[model samples]
Target: MNESESHGHIPAPLGSVEPHAPLLSVPSDGQLLYKISSVENLLRSIVGNYLHFNRVDSYADFPGADPHDGRQLPKDQQGNSLARFEKSPDFSAANYYDQSRARTYACCFSLENSDFIWKNYANGSEKGKVGVVFEFGRLRTMLNQTLQPGNAALKYNGNQCDQIFSVNYGIVEYVDWDTHQANVDHLQNPIRYTYLKDKERFSEEKELRISLSAMGIGQFALKDGSMMQFPSSLQLAFDFKAAIADGAIQQILYASDSDSDFLQAELHKLRIVSSKG
Candidate 1:
């Protein structure tokens, strides 16, 4: 086993930064994180040895999802909006460039095994839904390796683009965006915003998020002589076989014995064990 595996905690990698310094702590190896989804989705992940991450923008379509997910601007101490520069065309273009280059793709897990997750996320259907538990340490290590610099790449306009990759994982913080004040400098780090959610989501979700970002370096000249960059791919598929080999998956929870039996047979085909919830 490697040092990280033995230690049960993940160290932030090259491009990962803690903008919310004191509040976020890496979860321990034994910490159980739950992901509730359809049985088909859960089986697909296990059979494919990968997890799919959707662009931050895609999440805006979810019910009760924060509208300002990735576009939230920092507020000054006096509660003033510090986005006055957004009105300028030049600044707007630049902002769009930055936002596109640093676009975040994320997958969510919950720190709790609440009925709310089963009801909303798993559709509350015993035959079609299930929850999977993962060990944080192994999951983090797998993500760090899968997102390492050259393991993934971005393309724009049919051309390969130079990019810097980063991966971050942490417990999400529920905050009232209107009342929260962030350092102006926080805007420079896109992953930081993924950790913050509306306070209304706190009680039931208790979310843990894994976010991946790529900052594009290659640029194209706009008609106005300004430079802009964008990514063509808005999603990422990361392999988790290594984590599974490390016993990252703890258990598969099913609502009924019949469901458990079906899962066991399916999992047995993949050499994975299944248990009743």
Candidate 2:
């Protein structure tokens, strides 16, 4: 058998990130739960929505199966020996398969916090923060848009009830292997895609109305450990976003660098709020 045949892997779709293999050993501290919980809480706080975490596991029949390693699967179908040996068909298209058949990992999810962030804040830099604040009706608009049959909601419906009826019992007519497979990736991944798409609608280029000096801070530190007082000639990066249902901020790092000339840095989301009139 060829080297690819000896290993078990399937080609990933273009632009999609590679999946990671199951951990051989159990995680030691279970701190992953805590780290994930913090993110969930941040999400909840930002968007008044809840976040949930779920994991899937799989084993690697060959090397380079770890998700973080970034070793992409060979394009040829030779890498999936387990499937070939079992007389299974190739799985290049997007669908759900077992762990024994291919590498697997968990996918955590929550509502699109970027929606809340963007709509709450005006399209430009207000005061000192440099991100959108979701509008009052934006979440409602997003939910209405999402649930409009054949949209992302139908994909997440698990039963495909809505999708099936859209074309006169189309979903029921095609529930089997010949028709479709139950894959949650589309539903789970759309949050980021939706966020990016929404971001494109806003033109925040010239609306920034705040100065770096106006941001409240006694001291700041650079990655190089350089320290400086506030309100100096040096520039600052600013970012802000709404919390998810679980009260956690969406992944920060959405703003651009303030200093275009001499310095460069992305701003970290600040958890603490300061009050100064």
Please list the residue runs of candidate 1 whose C-alpha ends up more than 4 Å from where it truly belongs after superposition.
Answer: 1-24, 60-62, 73-89, 92-102, 124-126, 150-163, 184-188, 216-242, 256-258, 275-277
So what's the TM-score on candidate 1? 0.70
What is the TM-score of each predicted model, taking all chains together?
A: 0.70, 0.20
Indicate which candidate wins on lDDT. Answer: 1
lDDT of 1 at 189: 41
On residues 31-147, what C-alpha lDDT tens digit does candidate 1 reach at each position?
899988777777777676667676666655446665565545445322223332433423332353246435667688998888878777755345577787888877776666655
lDDT per model vs. reference: 0.59, 0.22
Please estimate how well model 2 matches the true structure, expressed as its whole-model Cα lDDT: 0.22
Best by TM-score: 1
